[model samples]
Structure formats: C-alpha cells, structure tokens
Target: MITKDVRNWLGALTFLISLCLSGCQSGNAPASSPIETNRSLAPQRVDIRGSILSSQYSDGQVILEVERLSPSPDSRYDRAYVLVLPTAQMVDSEGLSVSISELRPGQNVAILLRAGGQGNRTGIGVARKLWIEDRF
Candidate 1:
C-alpha cells in the first residue's frame, strides 16, 4: 500500500536510525552533549616534588607553592606552583589515609601532574596525583 515517494522516505529514516544505533553500540564514543570549548585538550603528564612553601585551598581546589627540593638538571622551576583538585588522593608517611586540609606549609611532598597544559602566567602545571611525604 506504500507509494514510491513514501517508501523512499522510510528507507532514508531507517538508514539514519541504523547509523545512530551502530554508534551507540560501539560504546566508546561519548554521546552528544555540551562540551567545554574554552579548555584546551589534556596535556602530557609530569612529576614534581618539593617542600611545601605555601598551600591554598578554596572551593575544593588547591594551589600549592612547592620549592623543589631537588630539580632535574634542566628544571625550569626551582620553585613551582602546582594545582591540585579535591579528587586527588592523599596519604601520610605511613601510607595511611590523610586529608588535603592537613597539608601545611614546610611539609615535604611529591606531586604527579597528569594532562596539565604548558604553563603561561597561571603556573607550572595542574596535578592529577599528589602524595604527602613523611615530614619526620
């Protein structure tokens, strides 16, 4: 009972639906949603460690002033400003649970930064991983 024009429209709709379903089935690609357009793509990870010269926490985010205890021969920052998020894990000298709020100035710590963009005026890098060394 379908006319020729109606059949063609149905065929096109079916093709589009199939394409969408295939994409969904893959399950790897993110679905269409609002994306942050201003932020740059994630960058390569890096590692830095030093004594805590200063620590600032607000709105569940942290910026630490770390004086590199020992820098690589080519290190650009004898003291670097490192960014840490609330999601970053924290541990104590004995490898037990610690809170970011306990971190104070003059504590020796090590930080691992992942997906941090290159520095400009903001600071050195953003930290994806952070650990507090035993200040004892």
Candidate 2:
C-alpha cells in the first residue's frame, strides 16, 4: 500500500501534468503569424518635429505636416500625420502644461510617437508626448 506522502506526491504530479497539457493545447484559438506576433509585442517609437496644420479640440486630434528636420529612416517625407492626443502629455514653449485647445495652426511642435497599427509608414501615430516649440 502507498504511504500518505506518496499518495499526495502522485496527486500533485498528476495535477501538474494536466496543467502542462492544457497549456500546450491552443484550443479553438487561431495561431498568430510571426510578424503579427512581433508587431503586437513591440511598438516602435518615433520622434518628429513639425508644424500643426490643424487641430480638433473636441476630438483631441492634431494634423501635423512634417518639415523633415532631422528625419529618421522610418520618417515619411512631406506627410501629414493625424495624431491621437487625448492621453498625450502636452507642454508649451515655457514647459508649462498646456491643453489641446491651446494648440493652433502654424505652431511648431516636437512630438514623441508610439507607432503602431499601420506603423509610421501610413502617417498614423499615437502621440505619447508633445512639446509646443517656439521655433523649429
């Protein structure tokens, strides 16, 4: 007859095996392609300096037409990026916190972007932080 300790150990081992098997099985979920998995895991960060073409305060969105100053390899030339800004931290030229309504057309701004979804190639980006520049 098995001892109480042996019985308990066997039960724990069986439970662990079942847990491993369940984790290994994907069930009804479809497998994601390697590219899609990589994209979801890591988002690229992009920094850009441009002038605001227009802004919609109600929507918390800004349209920035890049001036191509110190362009990155991923930067698209002469593109207007429609950036979502509701969660972004905005600071003025004086480094004071500013609201979306304070932003106006023709104001030079430097923005740090978290490029996802269609990526930076499509000029679609989420603004992580924005600085209203006095000059570009």
Please give the CA lDDT of all the candidate structures. 0.65, 0.61
Q: Best candidate, TM-score-wise?
A: 1
TM, every model: 0.54, 0.49
- Please list the residue runs of candidate 2 whose C-alpha ends up more than 4 Å from where it truly belongs after superposition: 1-46, 59-77, 116-122
Could you give candidate 1's per-residue lDDT for residues 59-113 as a string of tens digits?
8877898876764542335666887777776665455666778889988776665
Model 2 lDDT tens row, 12-115:
99999999889878675577655343322111333556667766654546555545445556344334465656667888755578877787888776666675
Candidate 1 is scored at a TM of 0.54
What is the lDDT, from 0 to 100, of the residue 118 in candidate 2? 42
**RMSD of each candidate relative to the true structure:** 10.8, 11.6
Q: Any residue pairs clashing in model 1, and if so which?
A: none
Off by over 4 Å in 1: 1-46, 71-77, 116-123
Alpha-carbon shift of residue 118 in model 2 (angstroms):
4.2
